[model samples]
Target: MASDSSFDIVSKIDRQEAENALNQARKEVEQRYDFKGTGASIEWSGDSVLIKANSEERAKAVLDVFQSKVIKRGISLKSLDSADPVASGKEYRIVTTLKEGISSEDAKKVSKLIRDEGPKSVKSQIQGDELRVQSKSRDDLQEVQRMLKAADLDVDLQFINYR
Candidate 1:
């Protein structure tokens, strides 16, 4: 009897890496000449990230720096959900949240995609916030991974636990 080849699809972020990126962004904002008088700042507020500046443009720039740092840390930008800048008192603020986990709807969408377009031997099952894909052939599993990578899904996905 042949056991099926399988992998788990998950959306997750390393909190420590994210925090390092935030720290790098904050240091850059503090040292950058243009941001000297802009009062630009980036910090963690609870589980979310906060970017504040004297103007909307500056606040957005601060966000840009943070995003770049995140990218440098090998985190996908798709995982970041950043709000538009809003005026708060004397500063403009942008609140950004890191998205993790596959929601039921997202898992369903991926499952559907697999069933509709993936190899016939491939099977997908949604397990909580993750999806498990199994197939008789490893090649089929790889093909499914390629298909998912090509799809323009809103969530960032990672393939793990391949065996």
Candidate 2:
């Protein structure tokens, strides 16, 4: 039998880099003339970020700032998923989701996807936030990767650690 090739699927972020980007965004907000007096603020709690501003426009501008800063810092924009604006009086708040894990549902979906569409020699298992796929043939594993890339899972995917 041939040796099995395998890889782990994961959604992880470099917390240090993310923090650096956030800090830069805060500094820019403080120095930018338009954001001044707007009482705009950014809050980071656990895996989420909250942006608050006096108005919806300002809130969006803050999001743009964060996006630009993260991009400048070489972070993927896929790391942030922003929610719709919520109004509290004259202020608007938008919660930016920092995706860090693949949920059970997504994991199951990926596992099933691999089982259904993967090469006949490949097998997959859902392990918490990740899906492990393995096959006796390297070509089968490569084909699995190609199939996964074409699947619509609404999440960013990466193939790694193949042997």
Candidate 3:
């Protein structure tokens, strides 16, 4: 009998890499001549990152620098959730949060995609924030991975623990 081949799908970010990117963004914001008098600053506030500047445009510019650093570090932009800058007293602030783990609703979407479009021999089960896929054929498993990667999902996915 052929043994089952399986893998788990998850959405996760490397905290160390994210922090490195944040540090780089902070350094650039502090040293840039234009930012010197703009009161631009970026820093971690609890579990979220805070970007502050004298105006909305300056705050957004700071966010752009942070995003560029994040991309250079090979982190997915989808892992970070940000919203429009808002006024806070005399300065504007943009708060960004690092996203990790697939929500239950998103997990369900992946499971449904597998059940509807994947090879009949393949099976999927949602385990908390991760989805597990199993099949008798390794090729089918690979095919499913390809399909998932091609799907336009909001969260970044990673496959792991294949056996």
Compare the candidates by TM-score and give the number of the best one.
Answer: 3
lDDT of 3 by residue, 27-145 (tens): 99999998989999999999899999999999999999999999999899989999899997999999999999999999999999999999999999999889999999999999999
Every candidate's lDDT:
0.96, 0.85, 0.95
Better of 2 and 3 by lDDT: 3
Model 1 agreement with the true structure over 91-153: per-residue lDDT tens digits: 999999999999999999999999999999999999999999999899999999999999999
Cα deviation of 150, candidate 2, in Å: 4.0
Better of 1 and 2 by TM-score: 1
Q: Model 2, range 1-163, lDDT digits (tens) per residue?
A: 5567888887777788889999999889989999999989887967788999999999999989999988888767876889998999988999998887788888888888888877788888877788788888888888888888888676767766667
Worst 10 residues of 1 by lDDT: 37-46
Model 2 segments beyond 4 Å from truth?
Answer: none
Error of 2 at 51 (Å): 0.8
Position 32, candidate 1: lDDT: 94
Question: How displaced is residue 54 in candidate 2, in Å?
Answer: 0.4
Query: Which residue pairs in candidate 2 collide?
Result: none
Rate residue 129 of model 1 by lDDT. 98
Q: What is the lDDT for 70 in model 2?
A: 85
